[model samples]
Target: MKISIFGLGYVGCVSLACLAENGHNVTGVDVVPHKIDLINKGKATIIEKDIDEILLANWEKGNISATSNYKEAVLNTEISIICVGTPSDVNGHLNLNAIYQTAEQIGAALKEKDGFHIAIIRSTVLPGTNEKIGNIIAEHSGKKRNEGFAVVSNPEFLREGSAVKDYYNPPVTVIGTDSDFASQKISEMYEGINAPIKKTNIEIAELIKYVNNSFHALKVSFANEVGNICKKMNIDSHELMDLFCMDTQLNLSPYYLKPGFAFGGSCLPKDLKAFKTMAHDFYLESPVLNSILDSNESQKNQALNLILNKKSKKVGILGLSFKKGTDDLRYSPVVELAESLLGKGFSVSIYDRNVNISKISGTNKAYIDKHIPHLSELISDDLKKVIEDSETIIISHNVPEFKDVNLRFSNKHFIDLVKVKDIVPSANYEGICW
Candidate 1:
């Protein structure tokens, strides 16, 4: 594969050398004369481990070169990678000036180039950026997208100290493109790397880097807060965190990491409140912990607003419990949503296969009686009847029956709090946060 990478900066320099080391003929392009001069002289543009040696060795083998002529580089190579910096501005927004400039230059070069060309965006950018780049290229080159050329979003996952190693050994290689030809070519370019190739849409690939970095920042701040509380209690925070990390079932797993409706189970609500109160009693400021409940409340209201905004007077809830296949109505978010709908003068009907009003006893009865006095009147065991009587339906559980409810009834509006796998987004169906 012959490749041209724009912006001979940190990521560009390492990628050029490493790809060349992987047997791909690479050309480094830049506007800076000194950076181009250094690369042409068989010297790396950045200070990193093993990059200088790799670049020098690849240069000696004639697999690597540098040039400031973007037109010539694009005409020679089959693929072009945009690795220009997307630094922050005064208002904390990304200034994509360099990225647009590089895109324009590549588009101009592609004007005279023949055959299909693939341009990969290796910089961290927000969603919808790939579409904008594709549009820019189409406008400049006087060709349609995916007709003569394609734009791909393939973000880099390289750390500063281990950039060379990280390039070869990443957790996963993400390729986001609409063109099948581009996806195949990009996959072939990374054929030797020992990592799973995750092929997705362009927007998802573009937004993943921001999501990863934001979660990493949250983890660091959360750990610091826990350490602060542990110090005040004279406990070993490191040991406690090590033990916490060992729990692969829930704590350190993907158990609760999903975008959905508010969490309203018995253990979670009770324990989260307990932790927040404990920190408050100790005079500890745990913003992250304290904000959890507020965020959950906001999610509940968001679901409520989505239903209310539909302007339907009749609403149906598919599941009444906190989870599926369970009769536990204790702290169920769907139950609260039903109660709110009733309060708003909207007729509400509910269907739960597992929830039997006549059989429920103890705290479950007490909770329902206090929150919704006319529970028996609103509850129905027949699934089709509940869906038929309501104008809008809320599917909170990802059950098999709820999956095709949207498909079967195309006229009724469907609000999905849980992203049911089989449910497709259409005019009558909408997910809460997806």
Candidate 2:
């Protein structure tokens, strides 16, 4: 396959060398004449382990070259990979000037060239960027995407130091775009790589990089916090962590790893309170530990604020339990927030996919029912009826029906306390955060 990669930065240089080494005719494109000269001279523009050998070998073998001509590269390739850098703006938002400019250049090249070429974005961008880029290209080229050409988002998960190995062995290969031709073309690029290929929408593809990075940052912060606390207490943090990691049952499994209702249980809530109390008693300023409760409380307040802003008497609450697939309401923040709304005189209707008012026989069930009188009366078994009769709907869980909420309750207003969708703010929509 003849492939043209735009931008000779870290991502582009490594990708060009690696793909060319695998027998693809790869051309590295960049505005920088020095980078192009470096690549054309059988040398890598950037430094990476084994990249010099790969770039030099590929260029010497006539499998790779670099040029500053976008038209020449596009005319000579079947696929164009956009690996431009999306640096952050002063306001912390992504600056897509490079990407948009590259898209325009590629579009112009596509217009001049008369072949169906697949455009793949390997840059880290925000959601909806792929579609925006696709639209820009199509409008500029005067050709329909998925018909005359294809556009896709295949985000790179390459680390800086070990990018070659990471590229060949990524955790997963996420391809965005519904076109089968686009998927096939992109998947063929990674045919030799040992990784699961995940097909999703453009937005999810864009967000996967950020989500992975943020989780890694969170893990680092959590480990540092644990180490700091252990240092103050004269305990071996590494030993404690080694022991903690050995408990693979709950520690390593998919527990407490979802974005949904506030975390509440006998153990988590009680232990958090105890930790905060211990910090206060020891006069240790443990803001990280204290912030767990503060963030949870703020989320609950956000849910309450969503309910209050409705200005309607009848508000439907979906998923009464703190989480779905469970009836344990002990320390459930949603239960407390619901009561606060009731105290303010809002008629609330509740529906839970897993919660059964009549079948709940445990002490937990009895306690929750007693605390919130008329629980069974306000609960509805039908989800559609709940949305139909209510003025405002507050989605607190990722229930099965909640996926269809956009189409189901398209007429009614929604205050989504959870980030259910990529962009939920429509005419009658209000996501917690977009």
Candidate 3:
């Protein structure tokens, strides 16, 4: 397939050389004369591992070339990959001038094109960027989107040191577009690559890079803070981290990664507080560790806001325990939420199959007695009664009994704290975070 890459920067240069190596006729396009001249002379624009060999080999094979002419490049190529830089502005917002400018140039070039063209955004951009690019291209080209052309968000995952290797060996090949033709073409372009091809919505494709980088940054900061505290205690931070990484079930895996309600079980809250307090006692500032509690509180507030926004007098909580199967109510977010609602003068009813208020004893019993003294009055085992009595029902647990409650009580508004699968669609249905 014939492809043209805009912006002969790191991403573009690597993409041009790698795509050419993948048996695609790739043209490197840029505004800078030096970049174009370097590519034309069989030299890589960016200095990276194996890029020189890849560029020279591809250029010598007549499979790669560089040009500043957007019109010619667009006309000659079936697909145009936008690898323009989206640097930060003064306010730290994305400076998308290069991306928009490239879109305009592609749009103008597409004015005279005859066949279907695929404009792939390989740049790291925010959500809605692909939609904006599509609009710009449509406006400039005088053609309708998904008819004359389609804009696909195919973000790059290449690191500077191992760009060429990363190009050929990405974790997955993401093709974010609405058009089937464009998706198929992009998938075919990565046919030889040994990775799963994920075809998804354009916005997800656009936002995934930011999410990945942000999490990576968070991990680094968290590790550094842990290291700082460990050094103070005369412990091997590297060995500790290595052991931490070995626990794939919880630590290194996607156990608690889902977007949902704030964590409020006894262990997480108590342990986190103890961890932060330990750092505080050491006179070490662990902002990342400290921010965890703040972020968790924010999520709880978010859930509270979502429930209160419904403006319902009677609110039913489907689960009262910290978790689904367990009868534990200590530090349960639902318990906190229920207390808040009752305190705010909103009528609240809770149904927990696991929790029997009379059977409660010890600290768990005392905890509820202090937080919600009228626990027995508000709590019930009858799910049907709770559903019928309430205007808004909050599903806090993923119990099998609550799965079809949405379908049963179609009239009641449901605020899902735990994302319940197979929910029957309704105007009343809403996920807390999703």
Candidate 4:
């Protein structure tokens, strides 16, 4: 397969070496003449682990070369991977100048084209960016997406300095496209790579990368803050964290990893309170750790505010479980939110795929039912009826067919707690916090 990679920076250079090593004929394209010259002369431009060897080997084998002309790269290659950079602007939004310009150039080259050429995006971008680029290309080339040529988002997860290893041993390869042709083409490019291929919607794939990086950032901040507090108290933070991580049964494990309700179990909520109490008892100002519960409560309050702002006499909720796949209602913030709304003037109806009325004979049911006694009567098993009845839909979880609900309830508006779509609604759509 002949492949053209735009931009010879870290991502582009690593991709060129890896693809070339995988037996694909790759032409590296970049604006800088030095980068192109370096790749063509069998010298790697980027400083990555094992990349120099791979680039030199592939270049010597006549499988890889570099060129400065975008026209030449696009016209010759069967697949074009847009590995351009999307750096942050002054406002921290994704600056896609390079991406837009590259798309236009690719479209110009495809103007006199006749074959199936797929434009794959390997740059980190917000959701809907690839769709926008595809539209731009389509407008210029007079070609339809997934027909004349396809556009897909294949975001790279390579960390710098170890990119060569990360490329071949990635945690996951997320290819965002609905077209089978586009998916197959991208998948074949990584034929020998050992990684799980996650085929999903473009927006979900885009958000996954952001979510992963942002969570990692959060963990770093948390650890540092804990270390800072431990230092203030003349304690070894590393020792504390080391001991904390050893308990995989509850802590440092997948115990709180699921996408469920807002963390209201017996141990979590209570222990968090206990930590704050202990900190205060010890005269330690632990605002960073203490604020976690407060911030969580604020999120729940935001949901409650959205529901209350609807001003509807009767409001219907699609799911009652804290999450989609769980029945544990302990400290499920949604349950508490529902209880709060019921206390107010608004009448609330609830639905859960996993929860039922007869299954409520246990202690959990008794605890929840004690607060809202009309629970059995308000629970509905059917979703169609829920959509038909609710004035405003508030999607709490990523329940199946929620995307399909947008078309069904055209009249009803949505207060999306989860960022479901790429382009958020202006008039009828409101995200909890985009």
Tens digits of per-residue lDDT for model 3 on 1-434? 99999999999999999889989999999989999999999999999999999899999999999999999999999999999888999999999999999999999999999899999999999998999999999999999999999999998998999998888889998889999999998999997787899999988999999999999999999999999999999999999999999999999898999898889877999999999999999999999999999998999899999988998889999999898899889999889999999999999999999899889999899889989988999888889999999999999998778788888888899999988766665787889888
lDDT of 3 at 87: 92
Residue-wise lDDT of candidate 4 within 331-413, one digit each (tens)?
A: 77778887888889677777777887778667678767776778887778888787677777777766555655666667777
Q: Please tell me which predicted candidate would have the highest TM-score against the true structure.
A: 3
Instruction: Please give the range of 10 consecutive residues that has the lowest summed lDDT in model 2.
Output: 417-426
| Global lDDT scores for all candidate models | 0.92, 0.83, 0.92, 0.82
Cα RMSDs of all predictions?
A: 1.9, 5.0, 1.0, 6.4
- Order the candidates by TM-score, highest first — what do you get? 3, 1, 2, 4
Residue 155 of model 3, lDDT score: 88
- As for candidate 2, its clashing pairs are none
When summed lDDT is taken over every stretch of 10 residues in candidate 1, the lowest stretch is 420-429
Q: Using lDDT as the measure, name the better of candidate 1 and candidate 2.
A: 1
Model 2: residue 224 alpha-carbon error in angstroms: 1.1
Query: Scored by Cα lDDT, where does model 3 land?
Result: 0.92
TM-score of each: 0.94, 0.80, 0.98, 0.76
